[model samples]
Target: MNSVQEGRVALVTGAGSGIGAAVARKLAAQGAQVVRADITATDGGVVVDVADPRQVDELVAGLGRLDVVVHAAGVDDPRAKQRIADALEAGRPPEVTASLDAEAWRRVMSVNLDGTFHVLRAAVRAMVPRRAGTIVVVGSSSAFDAPAGYPHYAASKAGVHALAQAVAKEVIPFGVRINVVAPGPTDTGMAARTPAVLRQAFAGLPYATPEQIADVAVFLAGEESANVAGAVVLANGGRFTV
Candidate 1:
């Protein structure tokens, strides 16, 4: 019912839960006709594995015209998460750098980096002809500094940031703009699963809600941020300045 994003169509990936779900709802509230895609479709959006190029291509092709594309779908398996959480504990056993779970790292990269690549490629395919669109990628602040425990997660996110910056130039001539939103520890289901000890390290920064991050995402997707492209707007709620 809002006129802010009326007539603007948007596609939100990983819309089943977490930040992706929040972004989809925010776009809808702003009056955008939002199409959602996720492995588990919670809001009646199509089920999609963003890592699959075929599925990503079909989803965007079906939309015909897209004003916004939000790629929020990413993965960090339970083992990897727990491994990082253990690091928060005092006197935790030291892990050999070479003994880490390589398979888990691959899964993280495939979903986080490959998934992002698939979505961006498909969005460009659909938007270039129209010569207009905004692509907003949900990146991670960890990418700014790949910590010891979560090396894979950090690398994958860094790849996404680099990809967006590189792709932003290619899409410039066609009138398409791409940007990234890197958020710090957000109070979502994912963050809640982590121990408080780990989160307390950044006590100086206020915890951000899903809605707060969505506000920044909506701004980047709309005309309000026309001059902002190829920029990584860190939404860490003052936790870190980068």
Candidate 2:
């Protein structure tokens, strides 16, 4: 019997590592033709920085038949993340909002928020005409429960949730479904570098693996989630009941 994704064409950004890589591999294993994209050429993936709208548009436009699109490319400046982590560990508050580093904030917004918009816009344009497609955005649990030290990351994800919701409505009538999978901290390279003290904060809390999150994303992208649309599925390891 043919699998649900057999012969389907899918695009996954940030396919170089972590959740994005996992999503790409799962889709391929399920028999989908997965196009891997990332800011770097890791794994010989297409090199396109989501932060650039032109690159995102071109990448989507070039995909002849896009049955599914998972926008998973995202970043957090490790230096800034660690600096705030360190301050919080020492019982000192990180800089106030007014004094937050402007560049760092802009960098996160550009890639997380603006980049999401660019990818969604381009994907919708391609999917609407065909009147059949699904989109799964990798979001952050921080958007629901604010983070202690990373306002930029939290804010960007919150914006992503809203954007996906708004756009989902507009596209559902055209047979395209858009949803978000917001996961808590997973065992990714980005999380591995987090300060020990910070990791300790969630020591006993539920932590997830990249594959686990990928399972959720793939589920939402396929027929199983056909009735699901414009929803944010939180895979945050029992952190919050909501």
Top-lDDT structure, candidate number? 2
Q: Hey, what RMSD does candidate 2 come out at? A: 1.2
Candidate 1 residues lying further than 4 Å off, grouped into runs, are 92-96
Candidate 1's displacement at residue 181, Å, is 0.3
Q: In angstroms, how far off is 203's CA in candidate 2?
A: 0.5
RMSD of each: 1.8, 1.2
lDDT of each residue in 94-153, candidate 2, tens digit only: 764655688989999999999999999999999999999999999999898887667888
| Tens-digit lDDT string for candidate 1 (1-242) | 45788989999998888888899999998899999888885757899998788988888888878889999998865565565567657557425345566777788888999999999999998889999999999999999866667778899999999999999989978999999999988888777776676677667877788888888888999999998889999998776686
User: Candidate 1: deviation at residue 45, Å?
Assistant: 1.4
> Model 2 lDDT vs. the true structure?
0.91
- Model 2 residue 14 distance off true place after TM-score fit, in angstroms: 0.6
Please report the TM-score between candidate 1 and the true structure. 0.93
